[model samples]
Target: MKRLLLIGVLGLALGGCATPKYNYQAVSQNISKPAIGSVNEAYVGDKMLTQGVFMEREAYYVPEAKKKFLLNIPKGYYLKTGEDQKGSYYQPVNAIPDGAAFVGVQSVLITRDNSFCFVDVYFNKVCNFKNIGEKRKISVANDNSFQQTLIYSGKVGSKINVGYREFSSNLARPAFNNDVEYDLNESKTIGYKGALLEVIDANNQSITYKVLRNFNKVD
Candidate 1:
């Protein structure tokens, strides 16, 4: 009994040292046909490794020992829809947005490897990925970041969000660019050199900002 109590106390002490986490919200979605020869390969790793991650903002990291990733989120209670107080797949249990409909959120856990072992996130009816878009392998790993692989920010247009899958049953290749449901500034997004890649929704909108690299310092 004494040993158990000691272990419990240690656990509580260690938990206090851990940083408080943040919530990351998925951007809205939009669709765009890339210019005939444009290829974009960007990821969160570049910024994440350097800036670390913001608690309460959705972010993930691949554990050093494993190639998998960890999704930083609290376990949402099992609920019928986002509006239902019991639980929601559309929003958090404590907070609910109006007009959102989702079944329930299944809790996904991660190990020391920091990788997500289960691709079964899709199986959960409460997931926001109901419109299962295309799957693209983001080179979130260090080796790829060293090579300056482009990571999309998932923002397609000014008011739209284009999201993708990180965990899948099949492994994908690097440098392979897939069709995006939205433009660069719409859905998946990352920031470089204090300038954010703004999602340009109109033909008149320009994406002429330079995405400078500062990963060498972090590397």
Candidate 2:
């Protein structure tokens, strides 16, 4: 009888250790507000540069050979990494940029049926679309000058527009424009890569984006 009792205690202890240290369901229920898009800024030395919107949700931050996996958790969801570990859970609160050596932003879009997270790091810039339905526009600026405008549409057979100009040099000139067609049944991310603007659709289990134009000429 004592042997059985010892075995039961050991089993109970192991089972308790197997459970995650953090409560994922409690964290998910604590998120009372909706997730919103944000821009993470990057700097070279002391000079500030505009690093685009968050694009890649999952990535490894390798700073001086040390690697750490950074995962974006949605507002209403929690992430559990391993078992028998303490504080290995992540819950979304605000924009937490990846890496200690880098300055950037992490943005995520959460709907009733889907969750999309992305990161904008270093010199790479990306634009985010969240709560897209019918027609909506997102504009970012410094001081009073207009910087970039992200237009979104959920209408079938409609087109999304992105209009902006350089704030430093071309402040008075007309903003350049790019347009991408929208599909109601698809979820996508549209942004700039190097010099080209593209739209990525992740609908059919495959992700793809089309280059629209070279926006680098204006830069």
* lDDT (Cα, tens digit) per residue for candidate 1, span 1-219: 553353354331111111111232333221122222243333422211122111121223221222112222232221112112222122222121122222222332222332221212233211111111111212222222212223333333343222222211123343443223444443434343332343323222223222233322331
What is candidate 2's local distance difference test score?
Answer: 0.27
**Alpha-carbon local distance difference test for all models:** 0.26, 0.27
Worst 10 residues of 1 by lDDT: 12-21
lDDT for each residue of candidate 2 in 64-183, tens digit (9 for 90 to 100): 221123322222222222212221322223222332222233222222222122222221212122232211112222233323333332223434333333342225344454444544
Task: State each candidate's clash count.
Answer: 40, 7
Which ranges in model 2 have alpha carbons more than 4 Å from their true place? 1-76, 79-88, 92-149, 152-210, 214-219
TM-score of 1: 0.18
lDDT at 45, model 2: 21
